[model samples]
Target: MRVNNFFICISGCLLLVGCAGTTKRPVAPVADASSVQRPVQQPSSTVTQPADKDKNIQIRAYEPSVPKAVAPVHSSAVTSLVAQAQLLESAGDLTAAVATIERALRIEPRNAHLWNQLAHLRFSQGRISPAADLAMKSMALAGGDIALKRDNWRLIARARRGAGDVAGARVADRKARMLH
Candidate 1:
């Protein structure tokens, strides 16, 4: 009887959560199922880009942007994996969290964010040297992301302090602080 009540409470909570939405747009009116279908307009080879606000006159109307040489990177899967890893870490299952992060890294091996996360977990597990090493790997992959670089430097500083190297820690700390 208690289990049945618990399930009912859980279901009600899930229904409430599922019904919540973030859309700001007005809802459209529902149409009849028997309504006639309208012809879909296919996009032409030419695509129009918004004109610059500063320039009053339009230079080009339909300029096709250069095709991307590579496929777009999808980070949704990584995000989910990261969330799972964080949950595991928060639950004190450091080994499981590290494994989850490793799975995400396999999908995006060059991702500095994943590397940084793994390094942080390593640090928490008292593996200071490997944490610092992973931080350096993240630093190498931190292209155009100054904040990630700074964070890696901070990790390096922490690792150095853990190893009782005051001078190295100070130098790394200075490097991290220098990054604006």
Candidate 2:
């Protein structure tokens, strides 16, 4: 009976995992040999012909990409800068790391991620008030970003604890727990 219960529990966990996916999934286009249109290339003197010269070839057309200007301060760019800041902080250069993050914020003023990073940095530097303030700013700008809100609330909890505000820390901790 114990073994059967264990198996049932494992099966139930697997079932839940399988069901925890995105609401929608994209369907891929099924390629058909006869329906594919191969671009014809001009035969040049340097071109070599294979033994199966009559074999069909397929070349997908180049797809136009979105312009960089469409997204101000590209996500990768901000991520790279944040990574640099973390490296600087790890090297005990808190000032430089904060400067790097501040610059990133100037570029992406509305980015809650940058604010959250700044809050974390301040927390590490023992600036509890500023850390809490920056964390709150991040939370305000997070919009519908649940992950950012969770991080910000956790940071706020820590900041309050560091400043000896147990009551505030408990409240922030509760909010963070709700997100988790």
Candidate 3:
């Protein structure tokens, strides 16, 4: 029992050390204020200086120098929507997933992932023609990504099968196979 207690204490110490080393320090906030000191202005002397003469010497009122423009924060909506769509698809609610993906598309129309997801949902729902169309669009936007091309070929094959064009389906399947 004493030996077991000693081993447990050692294990606990090791665990604590592991956790301490893995912990991250909080990030410091970015300072937006300029560090440059503003020049002090003195009372003007009786001498009537010409308007244009001293204009160049006058320090502009301390407008806090405009901060550099930052890119917009990444929205959680896209990630959350994609997660919800995946869950709906996994639960066999392909229609719901498609609808969710459509909403995401409105937010990020150029996103290849969203387009591919919608195409997949359409294919699963047996909307073959639309699936093929979406897949083609995704492939075009993805710029020759092999995975997108393969998915496009898959949709084309499915569309051909749905249209009762066995030869077309076979040719599409062959194209997809060639991609490997």
Candidate 4:
């Protein structure tokens, strides 16, 4: 009986949470079935009719603006974790440092600096592909931080060079130089 009650309580709480999480959008007022107008069926004729112009229908593309460059703010916990990771890396414990950074990332997944740090760590470990990928991710989230993006581009160039793509490395290096 106790187990059944516990399950029932859990189910109810989950249902409530699900409902609370849903957003109520502004719904279009539905016309009554009887009040809705139906199109008249016209007999087939040879006469061509002009296409209907929907004056009320206008389509516009949505363009998202680039975010302005602003320094990222870190919480004390994250700052502490970064410090610890730095210490671990300095002590030749790259694996443990990476793990510590990963923990910080879990706390602030969108932090560009954290992603950049992870990319640098991966680069130091000679994981070329992941290092370049993580650096790209960091650049994507870097907003307008020219320095950070430049650093990421440099990292990507190095990764590309390591992978024997001289042309790709040159392109990345050019991009980094352009930021200056």
Q: For each candidate, what TM-score against the reference? A: 0.59, 0.57, 0.54, 0.61
Question: Pick by TM-score: which candidate is best?
Answer: 4
- Tell me the alpha-carbon RMSD of every candidate: 22.2, 19.4, 22.1, 16.3
User: What residue runs in model 4 are displaced by over 4 Å at the alpha carbon?
Assistant: 1-70
Residue-level lDDT for 70 in candidate 3 = 26
Q: For model 1, how big is the CA root-mean-square deviation? A: 22.2
The residue ranges of model 3 lying beyond 4 angstroms of the native Cα positions read: 1-75
- Tell me the spans in candidate 1 whose CA falls farther than 4 Å from its real position: 1-74
TM match of model 2 to true structure: 0.57
Please give the lDDT score at residue 101 for candidate 2: 95
In the range 63-179, model 4's lDDT, one tens digit per residue, is 444445567688999999999999999999999999999999999999999999999999999999999999999999998798899999999999999999999999999999988
Q: After superposition, how far is residue 173 of candidate 4 from its true place, in Å?
A: 0.2
Ranking by lDDT: 4, 1, 2, 3
C-alpha lDDT score of every prediction, in listed order: 0.86, 0.82, 0.77, 0.90
Instruction: Give candidate 2 misplaced runs (Cα > 4 Å).
Output: 1-77
**For residues 1-180, what per-residue lDDT tens digits would candidate 1 score against the true structure?**
999999999999998887786458888999997796987544344444556765454333444443332222439988889999999999999999999999999999998888999999999999999999999999898786777888899999999999999999999999998876
Rate residue 77 of model 4 by lDDT. Answer: 96
Worst 10 residues of 3 by lDDT: 65-74
Give me the displacement of residue 104 in model 4, in angstroms: 0.4
Relative to the true structure, candidate 2 has a C-alpha RMSD (angstroms) of: 19.4
Residues forming the 10-long window of minimal summed lDDT in candidate 2: 64-73
Q: Cα RMSD for candidate 3? A: 22.1
